[model samples]
Target: MSDATSARCVKCWVHGRVQGVGFRYTTQHEAQKLGLTGYARNLDDGSVEVVACGEGEQVEKLLAWLKAGGPRSASVEKVLTEPSQGDPTWTSFKIRY
Candidate 1:
């Protein structure tokens, strides 16, 4: 299947200065711009967790963005990504509280 038509989901944990830096909001914005669906939220361990589901290429783009560094205020030190295991149910990207 083409990258544009294939569906995929990736769960990423962004570490290092991700919290308190508008990381979730920025991730939501980026996901929306890429037409991906899922959620971003602050984790208890001072990291930001993101679940991106959509076309394979879009998901990869989000991963790349996470690895390259997030929002201007965010100092991304590491990004860990894995294939999401659960069903893809999100219809829109959101910043979860």
Candidate 2:
């Protein structure tokens, strides 16, 4: 395993009522608060995809928060998590196009 593998990185696909909402912003805020680094983007399928990396516990906490959906106006129906590739350095979380 590489050093990247030693660090915890979680890739998640969040579906249901996530787009057109503040989910991305809220997710960024939450991830930053947890000291995690990642990016969130709106998918063409109307879902939100996120990739977060940090300490094991912190990454898990970020995933859990995403599972609960974001702030008001967003309804997260499902959250699918998986391992990501490479070690992407994120200075700050942002919404991707």
Candidate 3:
């Protein structure tokens, strides 16, 4: 129950034991389930970067999930988010290598 104006985007830098634990892939799955479009990748600093764009409520849901420790394998310590206008052109979520 949303319109185009309800769409939003955010960028998150997740810290902790995120990389090497299927974090990016798990994020893709979660984003897809929420009908979000964006990418997740492992940063050189051992953090996971995720950019999600979709309905405001769904995006918020994804943020909560990410903050709550993401996948079972991930030990998310902290997640920093910002209002970054992610690529709405991406029709699906993906794990950037």
Candidate 4:
């Protein structure tokens, strides 16, 4: 998708060894690199949940990277992505509580 049409948003659920590492931080970096605005957070179930809004290709790239295991120490097992609804008004990516 072109950057213009790619303004579509995405929300992802990442599973596996994604907690206690630098996943959130790394995700923030990646999101910033892609010019995405959203949040990443550790789920109570030991998974990482990421919501990003930006170009479709960039969002897909981020999802692919996360599926391949994030950063150096992450062991991602699965990644589920879906179209996001509503607006994305985040000024910066953050590690949500």
CA error at residue 39 for candidate 3, angstroms: 0.3
- TM-score for candidate 3, please give it: 0.93
RMSD of 1: 1.4
Point out the higher-scoring one by TM-score: 3 or 4: 3
Tens digits of per-residue lDDT, candidate 2, 27-87, equal 8888889877778999999999999888777887787787776767899899999988626
Q: Estimate each model's TM-score.
A: 0.92, 0.86, 0.93, 0.88
- Rank candidates by lDDT, best first: 3, 1, 4, 2
Clash tally, candidates in order: 0, 0, 0, 0
Error of 3 at 35 (Å): 0.1
Clashing pairs for model 2 are none
lDDT of 4 by residue, 5-54 (tens): 55767888999888988999999999999888889999999998899887
Candidate lDDT (C-alpha), each: 0.88, 0.82, 0.92, 0.84
lDDT of 3 by residue, 1-97 (tens): 5654498999999999998998998899999999999999999999999999989989999999999999999999999999988874689998998
Task: List ranges where model 3 is wrong by over 4 Å.
Answer: 1-5
Predicted model with the maximum lDDT:
3
lDDT of 2 at 10: 81
Off by over 4 Å in 1: none
